[model samples]
Target: MQEWQNACQIAAESAWGVTTDATSVQSMAYDAVRDGTSLKSQHAILATHRVADTLRSITEKHDRGWDAPKPRFTSPTVVYDERSMSFLDDGTVSLATTEGRVSATLRLPDKKDGYQQQYLDDEAWEHTQSTLHERDGAFFLHIGFKKPAEPSRQPEYGTVLGVDLGIDNIAVTSTAQFFSGSELEHRRRQFRRKRRRLKETGTRSALRTLIGIENKERRIAREILHRVSNGIVAEAERYCCDIIAFEALDGIRNRLPAGDVFHSWAFRRLIEYTTYKARSAGIRVTRVSPEYTSQRCAECGHVEEANRSSRDEFVCQSCNARSNADYNAAKNIGERAVRCVQQSTQRTSVSRYALKSGTVTPDEGFTPRDGGVRG
Candidate 1:
């Protein structure tokens, strides 16, 4: 049994179907054999492979492209429902569930020496539904378990990180807003140009080649987000900061002008993904109203046409303040989240109890948890 540690991992939920392919599982088992490890059961191998890949991915993200092995944390537990069929059931070289244990952790007979928790650690965990997705031929279980805790006090929060999310670059944070050089921008621009050319050459071979292009784009985009999110969270952690804040950005896509292409490339998806990663790392993410963050000047709180000098530069005419366009926006987002959190804490609330001993106090809209809202 291995020692249990606090961790976060993303489980694969295929976008297309239920049940993973037997081929994929068999390949993984063979790889296990090649590595001098005995072959584990199919389900156990599946879960282990997933854990390895997800952790490896996140490491490269924070390491800034340096090669590193994936970090290991937990044992994979394969699960099934009451009516589910199992080849291992009724005997025939199949493993059965061990008794008196949490259903999520599966014990592999092969790795009789795998991670076994001595006892519950008093940490509260919540099952976060990663993606309501499909795989194989049907939708299967793919839930992520993470430690959720209450934060104590906030950071000085003197410096705010403003973030503006867009299509190619999902999130252009304050750091990138002020520090990213022309190299990064040029690479992104070149990628877009190559992608455009790939689309125009629409033959069967071209279309086939586009798949690789698409995968590269997807991987690059995912990696960029990983790096940006890691950098932001790392900076917060370095500064002893408590809250990582941004706008709710709930419906900005729909609010855009008609035929706007930004809708095709979802910005909120990036925010949601980044928040999940940020929250898991213990860096709290706050959301504020996204009404007029851009138009308003961060320095003087002035709203005028002259504030935005160009697409990339912002100059406040009211106070003669000048800064990168995105820096101002990131600061705006940080300011809003900080103000919102402060205001939210000051509001009063009374718990109304029912006469009946077991009557539940309805968790109206938001349930108060550990002093922060989780509902």
Candidate 2:
């Protein structure tokens, strides 16, 4: 039981105001408390003291700077399996474990219910798959849970499934999406127009209203990403691919900042959610260096930036290959991931040998050395 894990579990359960008994918290600490020498030791209160010291530093940084104090503690805090030491009147809570429920980290609660099963509003809370950070007074919860165990992943026959993510399209797979960007883009256009008008006013109130618009846009993009990415992953299962690849984001959010007021890009968020979803299904996700998958001919690997003219159209300069922009990106991502994996296997640290296994002969199954398995 690592100390951090101990702290997080306390945070997660604390969301429901369920604290491990205070008596339990103290009893565990009793040995240290009884020994005067230990209690006076510098590392005696390492868990609580470290966070408090951090909080003070954060407060000082904000106090000296412009703008309001920074937010480090988050709304709806919870730490799972963190040993419960104490819960103060303030939001801060102390935690501990016996052997220690160290595996659990504090997180926003994600309970399973009929609503999630049916995919109701899609805005409901879900579990966090891995731990993240808590800095200053603000906390961030990575709002999705590890996929449940029952939906067993069959060994995907193919090793590649292509993925493409974009601002307008959100995400496009080798298989086309049932949903289109028409409605969402319309809303975005309307907001852009309104935002333009607000900018013309050039007043502080107008600036404030811009934040609301930015938040609304984020809300819309997330809603779209959540619904779409899940569907895409479920669909990829049809191909039985063991590996899924997406275009490397490459600081794309910075490339397309939604003006000064609104800035977070939900496209990246959708990919993150999808990556976890795929991982839970025992599928590998690889991000290849996004050089020019769309512009370069997927057929000849022709490198040309001019090949991609419109959001939908792709025309190669050298090889005369052409395809939809998203589809081309998806295919390139798949091919690149495959090549990268092959190269990795050939690296010096690797032995270049894999055990030939099970009900088949030594060379019966597919081999990467057989000039690249397209499947």
Q: Let me know the TM-score candidate 2 reaches against the reference structure.
A: 0.48
- Write candidate 1's Cα lDDT for 1-375 as tens digits: 111111112222220122123344334433443243322343334444444445535544543444554444454334322222222322222223322222223333343553212112223754332222235544334434455533322232222344655433345554343324343345556767887787898788877877876666555655555556666666554433456666666545644566655333434545655565665555556666886677778666788766888867899988889886766776666556545655575322112111111111223222122333211
TM-scores for all candidates? 0.48, 0.48
Candidate that would win on lDDT: 2
Compose the digit string of candidate 2's lDDT tens values, residues 1-375: 233434422322222122222333333443443243222222233323333333334433432342434223342433332223332334233343334322333332366543333322232423332223455755543333443332223222235666766655656665444446566677778989999999999899999999888777766755666667667677666544566667666634444555622223555666765765676566666677877666666556777778887778888888777778777776666666666666675221111111111111112332343332123
Write down the worst ten-residue block by lDDT for model 2. 351-360
Off by over 4 Å in 2: 1-158, 198-209, 251-264, 304-311, 316-321, 345-375
Instruction: Score candidate 2 by lDDT.
Output: 0.50
RMSD of each candidate relative to the true structure: 14.7, 14.6
What value does the lDDT take at residue 320 in candidate 1?
Answer: 85
lDDT of each: 0.46, 0.50
